[model samples]
Target: MPENPVDPPGLDLARLRAHLDRELPGTVQGPLDAELIEGGRSNLTYVLTDGTGRWVLRRPPLGHVLATAHDMGREHRVMTALGGTGVPVPGTLLLDPGTETLGAPWYLMDFVPGTAHRDAAPLAGLGAPRVHAIGERLVDTLAALHRIDPAAVGLADFGRPDGYLERQLRRWSTQLAASRSRELPGVDRLHGLLAARLPESPVPALVHGDYRLDNVLVDEHDAVAAVLDWEMSTLGDPLTDVGLLVMYTELAGVGGGIIPSAATAPGFPSAGELVARYAGLTGREAADLDWYVAFASFKLAVVAEGIHYRFRQGSTLGAGFERAGEIAPVLAEHGLTTLKER
Candidate 1:
């Protein structure tokens, strides 16, 4: 659990305790306490405890919502479907779809202990070798995730895998239109170029929409303890995942305080090396990577812009949000250039 977490804005402890008691009697003996999990902009996460037992809960942000951006059910369903698979997810305990409990839907799962590499500072003491191992383990885990068969896992109908990239572009474009607060240059141009150069996607796999190094928790032995944040998980093109990973690794140096990036850690594999490793392990052609990478940058630009919108409305709770507004243009320019180079 993160340190110094009060109820904050969205969580009400009294309602949470009463609901827990009603749902599962005697499971919670003492009074419940909760703290807001920091370092996230989309959903509101809380670490709940009853003296000894601890669980993590996820809910949507306080106000100004989008259509499919914060679907708690989608997150819970994907994580639940991935229970027995190689994908390391916490044991899901409960899910509430109604808003009567805590003003919105939320679910609970076991809290695994480890460090999530949001920035390079966490790996400063681990030396170069361990950091390299950590990087390898991250790619390995992504490959493992893509290998899972949705049919075998009872998730074949989770999403329409056909024309997934086109749908994705439309979806993100819709999201961007709804959240636009200021002038954004080149986003539409990048979108046009990406749509024009759409690649031939391979068999659909379990795509973690935001698969980056910081999204996974790493243990002391440099192993990925678990992959967190399933809010954006779906069945889609596997190269989309690879491209996003590459974009994050390559742009970690230039996020310029827009997004938190830990790819600068010593001995961490370069973006090209990581892409080759993924291709070698998965035995898949990585052609048309530039289009996908540009798409990733475009997607992240919209995400940062959304955060900036929330920040402007005073709905976001974090320090780094101030720079979010500036991130969209930088990423948009990068996306436009990436696609043009191809």
Candidate 2:
């Protein structure tokens, strides 16, 4: 691991060491080394190791605060609550909600060993059978999540379930307004269409705000080892989670074209198969999925536009952000076309 003695852009090693020492007692020993984990577009993540001990830390992005966007405590609380269930979240060791520790709220969790398949290339050599199984596991795991009772798991107060679809449309629209670097073509039209076609959500369940192959970790046995990136997890329409998963599965290039993914791996489950599987497992109605997919596209558009806004303001942390703005228009166009077909 590369060592930067100075405080890195998102993490202050000295301060972090002090807090870990104060809060965790003897969890960390010797000097602390922190490495910023790239590829996260929203909250900042870092890997910390003190010679023998290792853990992962999550905090908000450096600048351009968006209300309810990079919430550290919300993410931590959801993970902590879900631990008692079948969900495979990292074990929470500490949560520093106040800024007195390292100038921002952060949480430390046990970094379990698994691979987050970000793109298709990583699973290429695993052959079609394993890739197909990976896709099946992804959908099944989502079904598992949707089956959990939020109240039973102590997450009933996470978010309001009534009028979730309506509130989501308004919420993303507000996010767009907050990050409006420039007028995005078709965004407003897409939002209006989504609002005009809000579907009756099934019984509210625990929804992983961003549900995709990359957001999960797959182990050597081709099973989903852990579900990650709970920054957006909340109580809402479960179909929205399926809709987002459907958007990411690329079967023979027929699905989402925004980014190449393990979903495109040979023999990976088709969007239809994933939808059917989730429906079969959880027995939840999937009829209103088209509207949900369109909504997912709208949500992604606003999220991309926000990243673009931060990039323009020089607030983003990693590379490839220069092209983040380019995805919003494409997503919006897809959203419009998706709704038109229904």
Q: 1-342 in candidate 1: lDDT tens per residue?
A: 334335667888778878888887776777677878888878888888888788899999877788888888888888888887888888787888999978888888889888888777777568888888888889999999999999988889888899999999999999999999888999999989888878888999989999987788888778888898888888999898898998888788575645656788788899888988998889987889998899999999999889989988988876688888887898999888877776
| TM-score to true structure, per model | 0.96, 0.96
Clashes of each: 0, 0
- Writing each residue's lDDT as its tens digit, candidate 2 over 175-270 gives 899999797999999998888878888888999999988788899998888898998888899999888877666222332433546777777888
True-structure RMSD, every candidate: 2.0, 2.0
lDDT of each: 0.85, 0.83
Model 1 misplacement above 4 A: 1-6
